[model samples]
Target: MKRINEQKGFTLTEILIVLVVAGILLSLILPNVLQAIERGNVTAHQSNLNTINVALFMCYTQERDWTQCADITDLTDGNFLEEVPENPFGGGYDIEDSPDVAAGDINAGKVACSTVEVTVGGDTLPGTCSGA
Candidate 1:
């Protein structure tokens, strides 16, 4: 009589158990990973806002006012900034001068010239350079 060798492999129940365990582990870890990504976006958005603040302040130093500029492109065009940094969260930066101050005034109605507002993740996260 010839002896037969039994080939060992993962049974269906064992495979199912492994898959279930894997799914459980993934479910536990995925939320943390998503949270980390969101936090990263917030940090990046804040940093971008701060960078915009610096550029805007530099523009103020040169022009003595913040009224002439309305957007990030103005900073680049005026050479106050080398390049406009992109918003990390997907929203664009808008320069909001003090509405009370008329255009061409020294203050140009700028209550806060060096502050930049940023909204990220479809406005899920909103922040300012001052806050950052």
Candidate 2:
């Protein structure tokens, strides 16, 4: 049987093929996009940590004692940093010293973003920071 003036449109197989290709492309690209976003977050996290470290340096120069400044508030209160910067994953950066960690460790004297660890080679260290 034949129909007159049949509409011209994509067949089911063609539509499905197009959808499959789109899905494949999306699958290939989505992870890369997500990874790039995470990388940006990691970079921002490092920048924030560096900022806090600079503030810590200022605190150390003024107080002349690491024990004197053991919290982010110590930096903020002392006018070293205008405000506290939160970790990218959430929560605030920590200032750790003393008996909790041994000397020469990253978090020992000064380490920010204690939650986010970055592994370079075999060493796993927290995200370093930079501040204004």
Candidate 3:
């Protein structure tokens, strides 16, 4: 009687097929991962803005006035916040004075007294009041 040997491992074709499937799966997942990271950055910017707003409100309550704190440096100097929050996209905060608008104006809704307009990546999130 003669004995025959059986296959012990995967063939080369099977290994190549597995590699191709893995590559396809990675291609589908990579973009979504990158997009999530970008969105996380945006969320961080928004959270920073909200923190500044709270600090400004606290300052206003103590000072009893709606006045800009000289600048971002002043906010840090007065200990409202540990330091000025930087825009996640890039650059520092874009400080702007509010225009004189009546109690009810279309633009008024987008403007806050003594506001600090934070421009991230050239896109402005309006009505961020730093003093009021």
For 1-132, candidate 1 gives per-residue lDDT tens digits of 866997779999999999999999999999999999989977886787677777877887887766656677888899867877777667576676545445554365533433333445556333344411
lDDT tens digits by residue: candidate 2, 1-132:
899989989999999999999999999999999999999988988899789889988997898766667787899999999999867766667676545444345425464423334443445565444431
TM-score of each: 0.73, 0.66, 0.64
For every model in order, what is the number of clashing pairs?
1, 7, 0
Evaluated against the true structure, the overall lDDT of model 3 is 0.68
The residue pairs found clashing in candidate 1 are 98-109
The digit string of per-residue lDDT tens for model 3 on 9-107 reads: 999999999999999999999999999989998898889878777776666567654454535565677788898886778887644445654324322
Alpha-carbon runs more than 4 Å astray in model 3: 1-19, 68-70, 101-116, 127-132
Checking candidate 2 for backbone clashes, the offending pairs are 49-129, 50-128, 50-129, 50-130, 51-129, 51-130, 51-131
Query: Candidate 1, residue 101: CA error in Å?
Result: 3.5
Instruction: Give the TM-score (vs. native) of candidate 3.
Output: 0.64
Task: Give me the displacement of residue 18 in model 2, in angstroms.
Answer: 0.9
Question: Is 2 or 3 the stronger prediction by lDDT?
Answer: 2
Model 1 segments more than 4 A misplaced: 1-5, 104-132
